[model samples]
Target chain A: MESKPPDIQLRRLDDYRWEVPQTGKMRTRGLIYATWDMLPDIRTDQSIQQVANVATLPGIEGASLAMPDIHWGYGFPIGGVAAFNLTEGVISPGGVGYDINCGVRLLRSNLLRQEAEPILEDLVDALFRNIPSGLGSRRKDLKLTTPALRQVLRLGAAWAVKNGFGTADDLLHIEAGGQIPGADADLVSDKALDRGRDQLGTLGSGNHFVEVGYVQEIFDEAIARAFGLFPQQITVIIHTGSRGLGHQVCDDYIKIMMKAAAKYNIELPDRQLCCAPITSPEGEQYLAAMAAAANFAFTNRQLITHWVRESFEQVWPAGPRALGLELVYDVAHNIAKIETHTINQVTKKVCVHRKGATRAFAPHHPEVPEAYREVGQPVLIPGDMGRYSYVLVGTPQAMVETFGSTCHGAGRLLSRHQALKAAKGRSILQELAAKGIVVRGASRGTIAEEIPEAYKDVDNVVEVVQGAGISRKVAKLHPLGVIKG
Target chain B: MVNNSDPPKSKSGYRQLAHTADLGFRLYGESLADIFVNAAHALYGVMTDRRRIRGLECREVVVEAPDSGALLVEWLNQLLYLFDTTGFLGREVEVQEITSQRLQARLRGEPLDEERHQLNTGIKAATYHNLEVKETAAGWQATIILDI
Candidate 1:
């Protein structure tokens, strides 16, 4: 493990919480949820310092929080969460990340693992062929015209359903019904539009993938049943985001925010944390453009879902309806949302920034779909491709302490260079095959970089959240077949 | 003076740096203009094998920023925009003129032919995380982290 930075001091508040006291320009304290055993690894990076940095932001409420999967990110730590008072708070592009609304969607199928195991390779091949994956991959058959692309930006996943991509039922399980409000396509740049034109259905590289797996174990049978998951039942998970369009939007806004920060005299410890007040013209414009990019991401996943169903149809000759392939839930991990959270015994609207974090609204929250309102929002946590991913539910504790947020995934423990070195002279493919898992990838480097051991164990990450009472585990899914971009 | 006619085939100007969740590199050049050129080379180096690219196409690029840090990011992002939208990969970059406020360059490369070239990684964007551009005893040095 790398040595911890000496300046960061932590006091254990409880079994699963560590306190970074407010000091030196901080407006609030910093809270981190992690087991003691994970501290040595957590302290290995500058993420702890970033938590403190976030506390220093203006109008920050309660505390700056980091989840167990926390790692050093550009401005905010990955798995970081913060809430700011609407009047005095600031909205930053860094907090939402480059891949705006980068998220995951789960599709539960009626088929059993035994049924998919026989044709797993062919099934994965079909999915890989149907869904474009990798760097610079674009569909030759479905490039959107400029006007249609603008409609996609405006309508989000609704555009996909209207264009015959997926059913309206798919949107019901999505966060914000697969469309964030306040999106203005005109606020989005022409460059961003061009980048997203032909890239809608493509899964651009790096940690984005489509995986076929099965429910290996269930932690909460009632919640698992509520989520339409059963033991040994096959499932599909699509993990991606707004692609190049989002990247361009973020790049374009950082430049604008840089000047806006200076214009507004908002002090920034890091340039990446540059922002404008929530009510500022710059902030409103950014929010609008960001929502548009988020909508693009929702539509991207919707189109991919359409193809995933078609891939199954080609493989089994049974339709998606017969296979019972229905969307369980879709949640965005990287985003900022305007939420009403009670602070200091008063309810107020605050802009909540969840960077590399998932919103886990407590049971019966209105945002939770009607079907899942009793169990809370379904949170999908994807592990590294070779190991097991998890299904989790939001808890009241999370809503109270974390602005209804939880860890997104098994955060990176090793860099790409380290993973590549470790993978040397070893065939990662054959190794995974030996474990009875089938895999295909667009880039060899992406595969090596995503070696299972390169990340912290999802089991450990979920355990911390569960132990902390922030999120409750529902089920664990073991990978059977995978396609990585 | 470095030869403008020759491409940056040598790895001396830039070296990979370890970053936990992204790709990073340290660049060295004799002047700010040289570092800008090397930064573009390093950016493409992370995306694909630069050796396979040839100077078969040329494009003119211009960008402006309020300071050197933002300028560096803008310069790199412009090259990335071209690559993402037009499939134009840069093998050589020549900064014709540069200041803290503006930069103009001539890019030489060919459009990406996936069948002929080996793509290694996909970079999302260049970040301002601990970004630096300075003149040291060794001349000019820059540190950049690219989100992948």
Candidate 2:
């Protein structure tokens, strides 16, 4: 296949990590996490230039980082991660991207993978019906009143559980315990609120999906068992985010961050790096709103997750006991979090922006859930609905070198237009069905636009991180069914 | 006329549209501050059919900025806010002047007749994906895309 990687003037550091030094207007170096083989594709991309451009932003710390699945995006490239000092630096909405808290969650089941393979058709149809998808998809049952919705903004997955979506135990398995602290409802616009009111518990369009899969391989015998992941075991994955409200919040703030850069006299090579001092009023309001939207994203998934569990009840007629469905863990992406990172042996608070990145915090980080703290945060990276996904765990190297972050998914290798054109004259469903995966969507174009070939090999992307020691692999998941928007 | 009693601040403001763009109306000013004011008028015009948005009684609209660029998105957002909150629409707009941080301008349009306020794509906000407000050799210029 023709590779479209950018010019990454590389200096190999090892078998895993490589560097792109400052050139042009770059203020710092750029880092690309890939193996020697992947370097050829990295060279074809212009996204490396974006990484250097990102380093030029005022007050950026460490290096501008891109994961193996790197590709050009609005401002920052997808699979990008950067941290800026709040006391002296700025925040770019482009760094966080417009999807807001777009993320992924994994659910484990007691049933063996062999059992799921046969009933995958029924499960896929049930999920597609329960989760309204495609562009502008909404539901009559999930809409919330203004007051109830405000609570969602504050509560996140906890709100969903409290409202009968799941039990309190589910929160223990969620990132940040399913609720980001410091979300302020007052920071949300009424229009944003209105957009989200009908969007909760619903999957919005473009790249959002639900996949049913089974563990295909185990990389580590010890970790796989500790994670309860074994070959041929059933698993479910959900991917979505804060929807319109988060988009509006970033929209509402990007312009402010732009002007704030000028007011503070911060030199920016790209205007898209608009930002303010973390302590500034403009910055605080945005954080509050962003956090609130992050909560909505968490809660949205929690509600949908409940329905997924219920789906098994209706399909198998014996609930999880017969169907064997269980919650494994959930994780978030596309978020800016104020975390304490040690710089020069002293801990300082920095707002780490993971635009298309995921937090892979190592074991014993105080915030990690008690049940899994001895192991590490479970990082779920979903591949295309038609192919496979993986289960990974955070490592100390991530905390020491990358600030506890890693790649999010199999980044797109083709744009929607390109994918649709490539899929022309091909029945994408027939293609997937032949491969043993059943696919369904609200529109034909959705399937065509998301054909597996539209994405990079997720296995390759995962290998880059595991090789770099930022994350460790546990199990591989091959798809059986898909439901997407 | 916009009741520009104060300078348009960061992440917030209002301004007038000028004859700057080639195929579209423009928001021109001395600084990012005032240009945002004109941006509001330009977007308001696009939201309504220019013919229908013209000649409604104009009123004073004031917006507070959390900062400058936020003020700019806030300014455009305010136009949507007015359409959403007050039902006013814009047809033709005039910019008096833009400063390093504020804009003062005039808008001529009719109140959105009850039926015109529903053409929303739920963008709910404007972003800098393709946002450009530059001081060119010819004059001040800017372009913005709303995420609909």
Candidate 3:
């Protein structure tokens, strides 16, 4: 395919890492993690320039980083990761993108692929019917009162559990224990609350989905077992976010941050990079509001989990517990988290902005769930529905080199229009069916826009992270069914 | 006054631009008001086929921002907010007044009827990435990227 060469100078550091040397205004250099073969496509857009743009942010520590899935985004490139000094660094909503706390959760079940094969069609149909999906989809049966919605913003997944969505034990496997601290409901706008009132359990459109797959390969037996995976074991992956609420919060804050950037006199390489000092009132308010939205997302996924369980039960005639369907782990890919990391052999507090990236905290890190602390946090990398997904474990090297971060997924290789045009004369549903994958989508347009060819091969993306020692692959999963919004 | 019942041709005020994972467009007009109206037309065009929509309901909308660029984002975001909250999809937009910092529009459309309207895109918000709104030799033009 024809592509553009990187606009910025790239000095390769090794087989898996490239360096964008510090230039004019850059406070730190930029580091990109990708294989040599992927560099050409990575440079096809302005994402390389965006990585360098992030380096120009004030008080950025270490380097602006991009994972193998890096792609051009508004300000910070997708798959971008950066940490800033708490007192001097700035907070920008663009760093979190529009979907605050957009993440993925993996569910493991005792039923093997063979056991569910007979009912796969029915199960997928049930899930599609039970879960509200597609553009502007809402749960007519699940509207929340204003006061009730506030609790969701403050409590996240815990709120769902209390409301009888899931067990308290489920929270243990979630990031931040399913609730981010310092989230103030008052910080959220009425518009955001209104948008979120009825979207709690809806799978949103544009790349969001509920996929049923099975463990197809095991790279690490110990870690795979630790994560409750066995050969051909059935699993469900829920990919969604805080819905319209999160979008409004980011939109609302971006407007504020634009003014705040001028108020703080921060020189931005791009208008979308507008920000304010981390300690400034504007920055604090944004963090508080963003946290509230993040909580909403966590709760959103938890509610969906409940419906997913119900769907399985309807098809299998066995309850979730009987089927051994349990949450393996949940992690947010789009978020700005305040964390402590060692830089230059000195430990300091910095705000980590991970957009289209996942936290890969090493084994024994206090934040890893107690059950899996011996192995590490489970990092779920879901691929296109027609292909395969992978489960990986974080490594100590990630903490040292990349602030415990790894690639999120196979980044888009084709524009939506390109995918649509390529799918103009074909039915993607039937195409996937030929491969033994049952697919259901809210709209044919969505299915066309998301044809598997739209994305790069996830195996190649995962290979870079593993080769770089940031994460280690544990198991591979092949999709048998998928529900797209 | 334009008749609300008359079906307008799919105007050539805007054209789609390719974006890797999101949606984008470039719009043109002879005036800033035209730019704003054309931007809305383009916005709704991406969401659904405008030919299927009718000006059954008219909404008076106003927005204020720091500058023209911000005004464009706020204006389109207002339309998005309307669609998300009330399912109101505007097909015909008349810019009543527009300035560098504020805009007023009469948006004419109807509530989304899923059975009739073919939903094409779910736009999250208009973003500020390389956002532009300026006068050119041909006329006024604006570029925008919507986070989908």
CAPRI-style class, candidate 1: acceptable
**Runs in model 1 with CA error above 4 Å?**
A1-4, B1-11
Predicted candidate 1 versus true structure: per-residue lDDT over A269-365, tens digit per residue: 8888989999999999999999999999999999999999999999998876788889999999999989999887899999999999999999989
Candidate 3 Cα errors over 4 Å, as ranges? A1-6, B1-12
Candidate 3, residues A1-485: lDDT per residue as tens digits? 11343478899899999999999999999999999899888877888999999999988999999999999898999999999999799988989999999999999999999999999999999999999888778888999999999999999999999989999889999999989999999999999998899899999899999999999999999899999999999999999998899999999999899899998889988888988899999999999999999999999999999999999999998766789889999999999999999999999999999999999999999999999999999999989989999899999999999899999999999899899999999988999999999999878998999999999999999999999999999999999999998
**Could you tell me the lDDT of residue A217 within candidate 3?**
95
Q: Tell me how far the alpha carbon of residue A139 in candidate 1 is from the true structure, in angstroms, after superposition.
A: 1.7
Q: What is each predicted model's overall lDDT from 0 to 1?
A: 0.90, 0.74, 0.91
DockQ of each: 0.45, 0.08, 0.39
**Residue B68 C-alpha lDDT in model 3:** 96
Query: What are the candidates' interface root-mean-square deviations?
Result: 7.1, 13.2, 8.5
lDDT for A364 in candidate 3 is 96
**Deviation in angstroms for A15 in model 1?**
1.0
